[model samples]
Target: MAILITGGAGYLGSHTAVRLLEKENDVIVMDNFTRSSAEQINRITAAAGRAPEVEDGDVKTKEDLERVFQKYNVEAVIHFAGLKAAGESVEKPLLYYRENLQMTLCLLEIMEDYQVKKLIFSSSAAVYGNCESMPVSESTPKNPINPYGHSKAMIEQMLEDIAQADPAWQITALRYFNPVGAHPSIAVGENPAGTPANLMPILLEAAAGERDAVDVYGTDYDTKDGTGIRDYIHVMDLADGHIAAAASQKHGFHVYNLGTGRGTTVLELINMVERVSGKHIAWEAKARRPGDPAENWADASRAERELGWKASCTLEEMCLHAWKWKEEMHKNTQKGE
Candidate 1:
């Protein structure tokens, strides 16, 4: 009767857990705490008014996953556990493949063993590689140029094959665009490990004086401002999409693109963040990151029509929410001293 969330201590997973709790679904959080923190668990408990059933275990381990399934009468799973650094995936392709692909395989096997059929996977837009058009649809050719993207693509394929073999399996792979921002209360937000590989987190760090300056990757791209353009969706919106997909009466393997259906360039995002935070963001243009796309937005009609979900927040709202979270984190750190 509980929905199990892998890596529930993470940013998006934690936000999704909050939403699930809001809907009155009992949540069982499974995490190894490798790249996450216990502070997130505390925050989710505070926001949701109840602590989720926490299971400290790795998804890659069969015993670990099985134990969790046995302990909690898990009805479904929202998988968010995996390595996500695009650049690092290129260098450590084997590690990426082993962690991402192997973990999914292990989890699926356990799900089968436990007879839990419903699964909602957290996929990325990186699976699309360099899209031919601006607004990418679900039918776009999946020619992933990076190991990270390839890993996600492989998982999608695996899910399809699994569903085809068994008719009872209900799988939904949500291909997410760039997810930014935080919960409105500033109770929880992204906490990246080491230097963040994503633009939004890096920009926020620069604004908070945690970093020297933000590096604008590839300013020569053929975009509105000669910078890369990406569809930025709020973390909360992405979380809502996952909940909708999980509760759907529909069956079989399906994929949905989650985005705002509009593109924002790197420069525009930087300006918006600065304006929202009232902080000067020092930035420098850098060479293009390999496997980077010139522009990528989602044709989110499927999510709108099928799931009855559409992003309602604006770019300014996303930036303002993220700034508030960052500012609160700073004040909390100072107060603790």
Candidate 2:
């Protein structure tokens, strides 16, 4: 039985694929390569010690996904394919809605056709929408302010409805905080095209000398450092959480927050990256972006109690691993030409 990973060439998807393959699971990757590079597929193959069955197609297309399901004995799916830029989602709301929602719907139909009952969905903390309290729980209200977040929330609702209508489906919606760090092997890491919208990638580029300076989105938030606070969880830890969720015997729909349960401000993150990478990060404080939360962490007790999962990596460790991967990426680029 193989695990099908949508967008397996993307950052989080690739990392999760490595973890899955490490556990001796047969893997099949489906990606359109619209924003990802073929280099990522090769890197995943190198880390996994075997070339994964790669299918070049979009999840939004039924015939394409059906072909993948038929070719590989896919027993489960980890859905990671979607548009994820918060700022860009706001600019192109329809594009986000169409791509994210339609893809999930088509995939669900194919899953039904193939009788694939297990799913691990990639969700976000943005669904909380500027939470009024810190350490948000699953009971917190979902009031997403952006299309990207709204799409996740909608899919979660759809999953719940499907579970209610059927008893055999096992769905786990893992709401993630900010995922930073790279694999310790440094074989693969985030390779964003053009400008990055996430904080860690931008900081990593600045540390690697690919960019001049990083822009601190806001510095007047109500936090320890008066900057927007976020829960930074290591990507490996998040991947572990996914594996645990999939292996659990619990049936029906479940939602768990995968986070460190600790908040790190923008300034704190920059200082940590600078210290770890041994680079001077020249940063400029900029105005707050729309829909930016002042503080958002997670009460991951549910995940800890249920999945026996908790993030063990420190912020410094994450920065160190990310810096190592960035250096490796730089070296690889130099050797390529």
Give RMSD to native, each candidate.
1.2, 1.2
Residue runs of model 2 more than 4 Å from their true location after superposition: 334-336
Candidate 1: C-alpha lDDT: 0.92
Q: Predict model 2's lDDT versus the native.
A: 0.90
Please write out the lDDT profile of model 1 over residues 214-313, one tens digit for every residue.
8888988877789998999999999999988987977789999999999999999999999999999999989997767889999999999999999888
**lDDT for each of the candidates?**
0.92, 0.90
Ten contiguous residues minimizing lDDT sum, candidate 1: 328-337
Record all residue pairs in model 2 with backbone atoms less than 3 Å apart, i.e. clashing.
none
Off by over 4 Å in 1: 335-337
Model 1 TM-score relative to the real fold: 0.97
Please report the candidate that would top lDDT against the real structure.
Answer: 1
lDDT of candidate 2 over 1-337, digit per residue (tens): 9999999999899999999998999888899999898889888978777777789999999999989988988889999999898889988999999999999999999999989989999999888888888789999999999899999999999999998898899999999998999888888788888888888988988998989988888888768888988899998998899889879877899999999999888899999999998899999989988768888999999999999999999999899998898888887788993
Residue 103 accuracy (lDDT) in model 2? 95
Model 2 vs truth, CA RMSD = 1.2
